[model samples]
Target: MAEALIKKHSRTKLDMTQGPIMKLVILFALPIIASNVLQQFYTIMDTLIIGNFCGATSIAAIGTSSQPVEVFMCVFMGIGGGVSILVSMHTGSKDDESLRKTVKTSVSFTYITAIPLAVLGIILTPVILRFMNVPDDTWDLAVLYIRIVFVGLLGNMGYNMNAGVLRGLGDSSSTLLFLIISSVTNIVLDLLFVAGFGMDVAGAAIATIIAMYLSWFSSVIYIIRKYPHIEFSFLPKGIDRESLKNILKLGLPLGFNNSLYTVGHILLQTLINLQGSAFMAGASVAGKIMGVSSVAISSFSQAMSTFAGQNFGARDYGRLKKGGRIVPLYSALITMSLGIVMYIFAPQLVGFFTKDGMAIKYALLCVHIQIPFQWCFCVLNTILNLANGIGAVRYSTVVNLLMLWAVRIPSAYLIATFWDGHYVTGGVSISFVFGMLAALLFYRSSHWARICRA
Candidate 1:
C-alpha cells in the first residue's frame, strides 16, 4: 500500500520533464524566494526591536553576537544541502524509500549534533564576545543575546533541515508557510518582549528563539502528517553505509566551504570592530539590510540546486542547461531592481536602526557600493547551485573557498592597509568585486557544464 502510494505520486509521473525552461524555473524558484525573503524579514524584525526599544548599543550587540551563530547555521544548512541533493537525485530516480531513509537519517543527525552544540554555545558566549573584541558598553547585551540564541540552536538546525527536505521534494510552498508563521511570530514577540516588557536585546533574542522553535516544531509535525512519503521509523534499521558515507562526504566539504567563506566575513567583522562601536553598529545594520537582497536571489540559488539535482538524477542534461540559463537571468533582474529600490530609500531605511547622522551616512554608502556587486552574485550563485545539484562538489567547494581566502581576504587586507581614508567601506567593496569576478570565471568554465552532464 505504501509502495502503491509512492508509485502514484512518483516524480516522473508528474511530467515535469517537458516544460519551458523559464516557466519551470519560476515555478521552482518563487516559493523559495518568498520563504528566503521572509527569513530576512524575521532577522530584520529582531534588529528593529533591539534598535528601536533597546537602542543602538543593543542593535550592535545583537548583530555582532549573530556572526558565529550565522556561521554555525550555514554549516547546518550545508548539511541539509547534502541531504537535499541526495533526496533530489533519489526523487528523480523514483526511489521513494531512499528519500525516506535520507530524511530520517539527516534529521536524526541534525538533532544529535545541534543539541550538544547549543549547550556548548551557551557556555561559551562570554568567551566568544571577548574574542570578537565587543566593547565594554555592548558586552553585557551581546553576551545575553548570543547565549539565548545559542541555547536554541536545535530549533535553528531543525528549521533549516526541514525546509531543505521540503525543497528536495519540490515542495517549496510548505517551507514558505513556515517562514511566514515564524516571521509573524518573531515580530509580535519582538514587540511584546522588548517594547512591552522592556526586556531589551535579550528579549528580542529570546523572542526569535521562541519563534524559531515554534516554526521547527510546526514544520516537523506537518511533514510527518501530510507527507506520508517522508514519515518513517526513527530507529536505526539496517543503515545504508553507502548512503551515509555519501552524505558525510558531500556535507563535510559543503559545510567546510560555507564556514571558510564566512571566515573572511568573520575577519572583516574584526576589522570593522577596530573602527569603533558606532561603525560596528552601523555595519551591522547595513549587513542586515543587505540580507534582504539575498532573499530573492538565494531562492533562485536553492531552486537551481534542486532542479539540477533532480534532472541530473534522471540524466536530463537538457533540463539542467535550461535551468542554469533561466534562473540566473531571472533572479538577477529581480534582485537588481530590489537593490535599486533599497538604495534609493537608504536614508529612511537606515534611520530605523539609529538617529545618528554619521551612522546613517555610512550605512547608505554600504548599500550603494554593495548592491551592484550583489546583482552579479545572483549569476554566480545560480551556476554554483547548479554545480552542487549535479554533484560537482569539489568544484563548487573550491571556487567559493578560494574566493573567500585568496581573493576576498587578501584584497580586503591590502586595501585596508594601503588605501588612505578608504576605511572598511573600501575593503568590503573591493572584496566583493574580487569574489564576484572569481564566481563568474568559474561559471564560464567548461568544467561546470561537464560536471552537470556527468
Candidate 2:
C-alpha cells in the first residue's frame, strides 16, 4: 500500500518512466503552467490599478522598490528548493520516513528564516529605497508598498515551502489548485481595494498579502489531511544530519547567488529610476508584459525539474535523458510561439498597464528588444531546471553568478555608457541577450551531469 501510494503521489504525479516522454511532460506541465499564469494575474491587476487609478509614478515607485523584496523572496524560494531536492530524492529512493522529516524541517526553517527577514524589511525599507535612489516624488508610496509586502513575508515563505514539498511528492496538480483559488481571491480583492475603494498601492499590497496566506493555509491543510505520508508527525526519530546537510550545502550557494542576482537587477533598476518617471513607467509596463510571457516558461521549467529529479532519484538514466532532451525542445517551441505573439501584440499588452502614450511607445521598444531572446530564456531556464532537479543546484548557482558578472553586468554597463541610449532599456535588453547565450553554453557543458552522478 505504501508503495502504491508512493507510485501515486510522486512528482509529475505519474511515473515518467512509462510511455511517451513528451506526452507525460506536457500533461504534467500544463496544469502547473496554468496555476503559475493565474497567480500572475493578480500582479497584472496590481499594475493596472496602480497605473490607471493611482497614475504612473505610483507604478514606477512600487516597481522600483519591488526589487529588494524580490531578493528576499528568492532566498525563501532557495530554501524551498533545498527542501524540494531532498524530498524528491527520498521519494525516488522510497524512503517515506526521511521524506516526512525533510518536509517538517524545511517548514520550520522557512518560518524561522522568514520572520527575521520580514522584520528586517520593515526596519530597512526607507534605507534601501534611498539606496536605490528613489526620487522624492515616489518614495512614500514605495515605502508603504514594500513595508506591507514585508509584513507578509512569512506567508510567502510558508506557502512556497509547503507547495515545494507537495511538488516534490509529484503532486503538481494539488499545488495548482491552491494557487488558482488564491489567485481568484487575490483578483477579487485587488478590484475591491484598489479600483473599488481607491486604496491605491497600499490596497494592492494588502490584496497580495492576504492571498498569499490563503494559499499557504489551504496547502498546509491539504498536506496534513490528504498527504499524511509527508505530515509533520510522521517525522523519523533519528534525524539525518548528513542528509539535511547535503541538501543545504548544495542549496545555500544557489540561494545566495540568486539573491545576488536580484541585487544586480536592483542595480539596473536604480539606473532605470535615474532616467525619470517616463522611463520607469515604460519599463514597468514592459516588465508586466514580460511577466505574462515568462510565466509559461517558468511553469514548464519547474515541471521539468520535478520530473527530472524523480528519475534521477530512481537511477532511471534513460528516462532522465528523455526528459533532458524533450523539455528544452518543448519549452523553446512554446516560447517562440509566445514571443511571436508578444512581438505582434506588444502595444496592446503594454496598453493594458497604462494609458501614457510615451510609456507605451518606450515599452514597445523594450518589448521588441526582448522578444528575440524569449526562446533563449526558454533554453536557459530549461537547463537550470534540469540541473536543479538532478542535484546540481550548486552548479546552477555558479552558472547564474557567472552569467550575472561576466555577461549581464558588463553588457549593461557598456551599453549604458557608450550608446547614449537610455540606461534602463539598454541595461535590461543587452544583459538578457548575453546572459541567455552564456547560460545555453554552460548548460551544454558536462560538469552538471557529473554533479548528478556524485
Candidate 3:
C-alpha cells in the first residue's frame, strides 16, 4: 500500500531522466518562476508600504537589513539546496530508504542550526547595523526591523527546507501554492499593520514573520499528510550519521560560498551607505527591481539544478548534456526580454518606491546599467546551479569566492574610492559584468563538466 502511494505521487514528478527536454524544463520551471515573482512582489510591496507610510528612512532600514539577514541565513539556504539535490538524486534512482533518511536528517539539522542562528542574529543585530554603517537616521529602525525578523528565522528555515524537499520530488506546484497563500497573507498584513495601524518598520517586520510562519505551518501539514513514505521526524532516533555527513559534505561549501557572497554585498552596502541616504535608498530600490526582473533566470536555474541532480543521479549523461546546452539558451532569451522591459521602465519602477528625485535618479541609473548585462547573470547562475546539482559543489564554491571577493568587491571599492563621483555606481554595475564573464569563461572551459563526469 505504501509502495502504491509512492508510485501514485511519482506521477506528479517530472522525470528529467527522459522527456522532451525543452518542454520538460519549461513545465518544471514555470511554477517556480511564478512563485519567485510573487515572492518578490510581496517583498517589493513591503518596501513600497514602508517607503510611502514610514518614509525614506524606513525604506533604507528595510533595505539595509537585507544584507545582514542574508548573511545569517546563508547556511540554512545552503542546507536546503543540499537537501534538494540529495532528494532529487534519490528520487531519480528510486532509493526510498535513502530518501527517507535524507529528509529526516535535513529536518533535524535545520532545527539544530536555526535556533542558535536566530539567537545570534537577534543578539548581533545592532553590531551588524553598525558594521554596515547604517545612517544614524535609519539605524534604530533597521535594528528594530531586523530583530523582529530574526525571531522568525526558524520558521523561515523550516519552510525553505520543506519546499526544497517538495521541489526535489518534482512537486514544484505545491511550493507555489503555499507561496501564493503566504504572499497574499503578507500583503494583507502589510497594509493593515503599516498603513491602517501606523506601526512603521516594526509592523512590516511582524507581517513578514507572521507570513513566514504561515508558510512553514502549511508545508509541515502537507508533508505529514501527503508524503507518508518520507518520514518527517525531529526525534533523536531520526538522526543518522551517514546522512548527516552526506548533507554537510554537499551543503557546507555552498553555505560558505553564500556567506562569502553575502560578505561581498555587506561590503558593497557599506560603500553605498557612505554615498548618503539618497544613494542608499536608490540602491535598495534598484536591488528589489533587479530581483523582479531576474526572476525568470533564477527560476530556470533552480529548475536546472533539480533536473541536473536527477539525471546525474541516474547516470543519464546524454539527457544532462542536452539540457546543459538547451537550458542556457532558453534562460538567456527570457532574461534578455525581461531585462529590456525593466530598462525601459526603470524610472517609473524606481518612482514606485520613492518620489525623491535624487533617489529615483540613482535607482534608474542602476537599472540602466545592470539590465543590459542580464544575460551574463543568467548564464552564470544556470551554470553554477548545474554544477551544484551534479554534486560538484566545491568547484562552484571556489568560482563564487573568486568572482565575489576577487572581482566584484574590490572593483566596487576601487570605483567608490578612486573613480570620478558620477561613475561609482556605474562602476559597481560593471563589476557584476566582469564577475559573470569570469564565471562563464570557467564554465565554458568545461571544468564543471569534467568534475561531474568523474
List, in order, the clash count of every candidate structure: 0, 3, 0
lDDT of 2 by residue, 196-313 (tens): 9999889888988998889888877887777655655322244457656865875686688679788888877777777778878888788877877776688788777778777788
lDDT of 1 by residue, 39-82 (tens): 77777777777776777778778767767786667676678899
The lDDT leader among the candidates is 3
For every model shown, what is its TM-score relative to the native structure? 0.92, 0.92, 0.96
**Considering summed lDDT, which 10 consecutive residues are worst modelled in model 2?**
231-240
Of the two candidates 2 and 3, the one with more favorable lDDT, higher being better, is: 3
- Who is ahead in TM-score, 1 or 3? 3
All models: lDDT?
A: 0.75, 0.76, 0.84
Tens-place lDDT per residue, model 3, 44-113, is 9988898888888788888888888998899779888999999999988989899999998988887888
Off by over 4 Å in 1: 7-16, 232-239, 420-422, 443-454
**RMSD to native for every prediction?**
2.5, 2.7, 1.8
lDDT of 1 at 376: 72
Which residue pairs clash in candidate 3?
none
